[model samples]
Target: MGAKTALLAFTDGDLRPRLLRPVRTNPAELVRVLHPGYEVTPIEDDDLGENTYPPYDTSYVAVLEGAELFCDRRLVFDPPSRLPARVLEAAAGRRVIMHGMHSVSDWLGFAVWENGDLVRSLSLSPDGGGGDNIGTPYEFELPFWAGERPVKAPYPLPFHPLVLGQAALRAFFGFVNEGRPSPDDINPFEVALHGFRVADPTGREQAEREAALQEFLRKVGPPRQYKV
Candidate 1:
């Protein structure tokens, strides 16, 4: 299977206008912010290479009791909710991106917050295993979680809800770019393929990679549409 990727983002209240970018953080910093005392082995460049194995190559992992979370590999975790919750806290109310590639998970999901309030969240695994659609965004979900009412979200055209994995990235980054303080938003992110593109395709590999970049940038739909 290809690498398992996920788009985890935290944003300002109202769920729009801007994404909350917390201070710069890393694996060690994540430990302090999310789970202290938990052993964390930082993910180095080699860990992200194609040769890396499944789950391991996908998300950054750390050992936990009865649960070992590959930090970046948010989607593959059994419950899935566990990873995002920690991610939100780690954001501490800033917009951030967790692992964003590989693109595999039993159930793909998304969650957005408005003024620290969870507007809505939904997770669906292919097993027809079901997921949590609780109204509140507080609790990170695991199975056996049945909530009162299921909140709903508007789906973008041409994309099925089940296949929103790539779409999520475009939306968050699109929001991030449109709301950028200045030219910085237009700048490519340090990680992720957001800024990486082939100026001239010498072969099939580079050409295909460039095509993916074009599609990846469509999260905002049209740049002109976002202008006030």
Candidate 2:
């Protein structure tokens, strides 16, 4: 389970059907709309699979007929309930969906907003249990929360977070990051996305962000040495 994603979408209604259409898109304009005030330089074109978990300093964006998607690891907010105000503003009056997963930590999170109102948000991991869970469980989430799909013994959570993560990915985005492709699943490869190198205009913000990350890493220190 090496899959990972940091995806955000804003659409009029169902995104899956919109993605199926072959509509021309303006990726640069889409990036600008979502990342106002940031310096965005068009870099390359990439398919969904390759950009789902794009680099922290880069973003992959696309504007469909009535839908738009932006993928960047920076958008993977912990306790997704606290999505940045700017992002929420961009999603105003539109149905917004966000999904984040890190296979290394077996963590999964997802959030949904309808017309600027939060409908559901959840984030969880084995090591930390539920990080942030709000609103009622969606139909697709019921089975896992009910213990119907239990995790292996010796695990803390009722189910493997990543398993639920995959389910969430399919449920919200009409695709999966792993597993065999199903006939009904959306062919993300068919959807083209534009990549951009995003940076702050002043360079101060980027430096501060890097300094914070370094400080955090310093506190966490190196991995523990153990004999197997």
What candidate 1 gets wrong by more than 4 Å, as runs, is 1-3, 10-27, 46-54, 57-71, 74-87, 95-106, 134-162, 174-228
What TM-score does candidate 1 get on C-alpha atoms? 0.41
Residue lDDT tens for model 1, 30-134: 444444333344344322123112332233332222212223332333333445465555556643333233334434555554434455555655454446453
Model 2 spans > 4 angstroms off: 205-228
Quality of model 1 by C-alpha lDDT:
0.38
lDDT of 1 at 184: 28
What does candidate 2's lDDT look like per residue over 1-228, in tens digits? 267999999999988888756367567765676667888898878899777888767998777878888888767788998888788787768999999999999889999999889889999988888988889999999999788999667888889988888898888888898887678898888888878998779888789989999998999998899998
The C-alpha TM-scores of every prediction are 0.41, 0.88
CA lDDT, candidate 2, residue 74: 69
Candidate 2 is scored at a TM of 0.88
Question: In each prediction, how many residue pairs overlap at the backbone (N, C-alpha, C within less than 3 A)?
Answer: 15, 0
Global lDDT scores for all candidate models: 0.38, 0.84
Best by TM-score: 2
Q: How far is candidate 1 from the true structure (C-alpha RMSD, Å)?
A: 14.9
